[model samples]
Target: MTTSDVMQDVLGVILGGGQGTRLYPLTQKRSKPAVPLAGKYRLIDIPISNCLNAGIEKIAILTQFNSVSLHRHIYRTYRRDMFTEGWVEILAAQQTLQGNLWYQGTADAVRQQLTEIQRSNAKYVLILAGDHLYQMDYREFVRYHIETEADITLAVQPVEAKLAAGLGIVKRNSDGQIVEFCEKPDLDALDELESMPDSDKPFMASMGIYVFSMEMLAELLASPGNDFGKDIITGVLSERRVMGYVFDGYWADIGTIRRFYEANLEMVSPTRPFDLNNARRPIYTHPRFLPPCEVYGAKLDQVLLTDGCRIYDAEITNAVIGLRSIIGSKVVIKDSVIMGADYYESEEDRTKNRQLGRPDVGIGEGSVIAGALIDKNARIGKRVQIRNLSDRPDETHQNWAARDGLIVVPKSAAIPDETVI
Candidate 1:
C-alpha cells in the first residue's frame, strides 16, 4: 500500500509519561522524552519524526511527571500551520471527578487519554515509546499489520540471547502469528520461548512499538490493566489475533544511564546502525540560529560536535558534544556524552558568575572526563577528574552519580577543582 493509504486512518500516540528512574539526573529535571539525545535532538523526536515521515500527522503525546519541559518543547517545536489538518498535541495527566490518579503504566497512560485519542476518527492507533532510539518507517509496519489482519501488531526485533532477558519476548510460529509473549523472562522461561527452527537469532524481543485496531484497543483498555507488556499484550494473547513484525535495525531503549550513554557514544562511531544524516527522513527539532562550533588546536576523532561549541586545546575522542559547550585548554575528554550548555554566558554573565563565586558553564582547564555523561550547563572546575575508578554499578555522590560504570554529572551541577569521581 502507498504511504498515504496506510496513514489515512492511523492516529499516532506517543507515551511520554514514564519517570525514567534509570536515566536519573538527566530525567531528574526533564521527562524521559524531553531528555537531550545525540547532541541535538530529544528522545521524543524519534517516534514523532517517524510518524510524521510516515505521513501520519495527527499525533498525541501523553506526559505526566515533570512534563513542564516536555510541554514547552512540544509547544515550541511542533506548531502546525493553519492550512494543514495535521497537529501534534500533548495529553497530560489530570485529576477529575472520575478519578484522581497518575499514569499507572504505558497502557494506563493511553487509557486515561482515550477521550482525545477517540476524537481522531482513526481506525488504527500507532503506539510508541518516547524513550527509544531508532528510525523506522511506520508505513511499512502499518501495512504489515493490515495485511496480516491482526488485531494487534507488535514491532519485534531479533536480539541476542544475553540481552533478551530484559525485554518482552514474543514467540511466533512460521506464519508470524504470536503464540506466546513474556515480559522480562527468567532463564527457564527464556529457554521455552527460544526462536523456532533454532537459527542464530534465538530471541525475538518486542521493540515497545505497537499498532492496534482502535476498536480492539478501546475494548482492552476498558478492563483493569495499566501496562502493555505486563498486562495487555500478555492478557490478550490467548483470545486475540496478535502478530509480530520482525524489525532488523538498531533500536536501543535509552531508559537507563548506561544505555543512554552507550547509545550517544555509538552515534559518533565510524559505522553506526542509527543514521541521523538521512535527508529523506530527517529528525526534526527546535531550530536554533546559533553560530558554528569553534575548535582550536583540538585533537578530535570520531566526534559529533553540535553547533555553538568552543573547544580550545582539548583532546576529544569518541564523544558526542552538544550545543554551546565550552571546553578549556589541556582538557582531555574520551568516551563521553557532553550535553552542552543551554545558553552561552556573555561577558556580563561571566563577570557576575565570577563575582558570585560560580564557575563558568562547561569543562575547566586540565580536567579529565572519560566514560561520563556531562549534563547541560555543568561547571567543572580546573583539574577535576571524573573517570569512574571504582567501576561501581550504581552510586550517588554530591551533584554526580555513577551507574553501570558510567559517571553522570547532572544538569547545572558544579564540580570543584581537584575533585575525582
Candidate 2:
C-alpha cells in the first residue's frame, strides 16, 4: 500500500491517565492528561500532535478520571475542518452489560473500549500514553513494524541505570526481537535485563509507545489483564512476535511531581532537551487569541513567556510564565512554572478578591517564588515567600503542597500577604 493508504489504515489510541495521586493536587481537579504542561499546552497535546503530524488522523482518547476538562480541551482544540475525514474523539469508561467497573489498568482500559476502537476498521492500532513529553515521527515506527512483519513493536530506549529500576527493562536479541521483559526490575536484576552489555546506559527501557496489528490487538485483549507492562506484555513476551524499536530521542514520563517540576524547569534551561517550538513539527493547542504579552522593564533570562502576560519591573529567571499571567513590580520568580489565569480578572473579580482578603489572580508585588509551581487562577499576595523553607520532602497544607522540596500552589489557591513558606 502507499504511505498515505498505510496512514489511513492506522488508528491511534491514547490512554488518558487515571487519578494521578503522585501528581496530587495538580491533578486534584483534572485528569492526568488534562494537567498543564510547558506553560500553554496540556499533556495530552503531545501525543495527539505527534499522531496528527505523523499522518494518523483518526485518533481516540480514552478518559476515565476527572475527564470533563480533558474532553473539553480535545473538543475545543482538535476540531477537524468540515472537508477533512480526521477526528480526535474521547472514549470515556462507563457501565456495560459485560462489566460495570472503571478501567483497572492500561490493558483493561483498552479492553473495555475494544469494540469502539475496532469500529474504526483500522488495520493497525497505535497505542500511546497520554502523559509523556517527547517529539517522535510515528511513520518511521510503523514503517519498521511493517518492514519486519512484527506482530507488536514497542519503542525502546537505553536509559541511565538510575532510571532503569523504575521502568520496564527489556532484553532484546541483536535483531531487535524482544525476548524478555520485566516491569520495574530491581537493581539486582539489571545484569540479566541489560540489552546492551557495556553501554553507558546499560538497560533498555520501554518508552510505553506501541503499535499493534489489528488482529493481534484483538487476540491479546481476549485475556484478562490489567496493565500493559505488568500483565499483558509480560505474558506475551515469549510467545509473540514482539520487537523493540530503539529510540534515541528525548522522552520523559512526568508521572510524579518531581519529574513534572524538573521537566517544566528544563524547558527554560540553556540546554533544552526537548524543543516544543519546532517550526516543521509544531505542538498544537487551543488558540487563545489574546493580545501579545505586555512587559514593562521585566528582566527575563532563560524564560518561556507565553501570550497575554503583564510583567512590571520583575526579575524572572529560569521560569515558564504561562498565558494571561500578571506579575507585579519587584516580584522575584526563579525556577518556577507559573500557570497563569484561565480568564482575565475584571474589576468585579478584584472586588471579590478584596472581600476574601486575597490578592488579585496573579503574583503580587515584592513576592518571591523559587522552585515552585503555581497553578492557574492562584492569588499570591504581596511579600509572600514560597521557597519551601522547611526542606521537607513531602507535605500537604490547605492551599499548597510540597513535593521533592518544590512548593506547589494548587489551582485557585490563595497565599496571603507576608506569608512565608
Candidate 3:
C-alpha cells in the first residue's frame, strides 16, 4: 500500500497509564501524560502532535490513574472539524460485563480498550507512550511497517550501558530483525543484549513506540500476560516477524524527577537538541489566548519564557518559566522549572491570600530557587530559599520534597516566609 493510504488507515493508540510514582508530586494530581512539558505543553502533546502531523487523524488515548486533568486537557485541546474524519478521543478505564478492575499493565490497558479502538476500522495501530518527549513523523513508520510485511515493528534507539538496565533492551540482527528482547535486565545479562557491541551506545533500547497489524495486535492481546515489553514482545519474538526500526533522534523518557528536570533544562541551553518550533510540525496545546509575556529589567540567560508571564527585576538563568509565572524583584532562579500558575491571580485573589496568611501564587520576593521544580499554582513566600542546600537525597515535607538532588514543590502548595531547604 502507498504511504498516504497506510497513514490514512492508521489509528494512534497512546498508552497513558501507570501510577508514574517515579515522577512523584507532579504525577500525584495528574497522570504521566498530563505532566507539564516545555513550560507550555503537556507530555501527551508530543505524541498527539506527531500523529496529527503525520496525517494519522484517528487517535485514542488510553488514560488511567488520576486522569481527570488529562481528560479535560484533551477535551479542550483536540477537536475534529466538520470537514475531516479525523478525531482524537480518550478511552478511560470503565467497568464492563467482563470484569471491573483497573488497568493491569500496558498490554492489558490496550486490550481493555480494543473494542473502542477497533471501531476506527484501522489496518494498523500505532502504539505510543504518551509521556515521552520526541518528534517523529509516524507516516514513515506505518509505511515501513507495511513494506516490511512484519507482524510487529518497534522503534528502537541506541543507549549506553547505564541507561540500558532501566529500559527494555533489544538485540537486532544486521538486517534490523529484533532477535531477542529483555526488559530491564541486570548487569550479568547486559552483554548478550548488545546490538552494536563496538559502538559507544551498544544496546538498542526500545522506545516503547510500536506498530502492530490490527489482527496481530488482537491475537496477541487475547493471550495472557500484561506488559508489551515484558510479555508480548518477547513472547512472539521467535514465532512472529518482529522488526526493529532504529531512530537516531532526540528522544527522552521523562518518567523520573531527574529526567524530567534535565529534559526541561536542556531546552534552556544555547544549542537546543529538541527544537519545538517547526512550522510544518508544531507542538500543539490548549490555545489559552493569554496575553504576551512581560518582563521588567530582568537579567535573563538561557531561559524559556512562555505566555502570560510577568517578571520583575530577577536574575534567572537556565530555567523554564511557564505560563502566567510571576517572578518578583530580587528573585534569583537558576537551573529550575517553574511551571507557573494555572490561572493568573487577580488583585482580589491576592487580597484573599494575604488575609489567609498565604503567599500569592508564584516565586515570592527576595527568594532564591535553584535546582528545583515549582509546580503549577505553588505559593512561595518572601525570602524563601529552595536550593536544597542540605543536599538530601530524598526527603518529603508537607508541601515540598527533595528528590533526585532537586527540590520539588507540589501544585498549589503554600510555603511560608523565611523557609529554607
Candidate 3, residue 235: how far the Cα is off, in Å: 0.8
Count of backbone collisions within predicted model 2 = 0
TM-score of 1: 0.97
TM-scores of the candidates in the order shown: 0.97, 0.98, 0.98
* Model 2, global lDDT: 0.91
Q: What is the lDDT, from 0 to 100, of the residue 168 in candidate 3?
A: 91
Task: Give a tens-digit lDDT track for model 1, residues 6-106.
Answer: 69789999999578888887888999999999998899999989988999979999999999988998999999999988899998899978778999999
**275: Cα error in model 3, Å:** 0.8
RMSD of 1: 1.3
lDDT of 2 by residue, 227-305 (tens): 8877888899878889999999999898998899889888887789999769888999998889999999989999999
Candidate 2 Cα errors over 4 Å, as ranges: none
Q: Which ten residues in a row have the lowest lDDT in candidate 2?
A: 386-395
Candidate 1: stretches off by over 4 Å: none
Clashes of each: 0, 0, 0
Off by over 4 Å in 3: none
* Model 3 lDDT on a 0 to 1 scale: 0.91
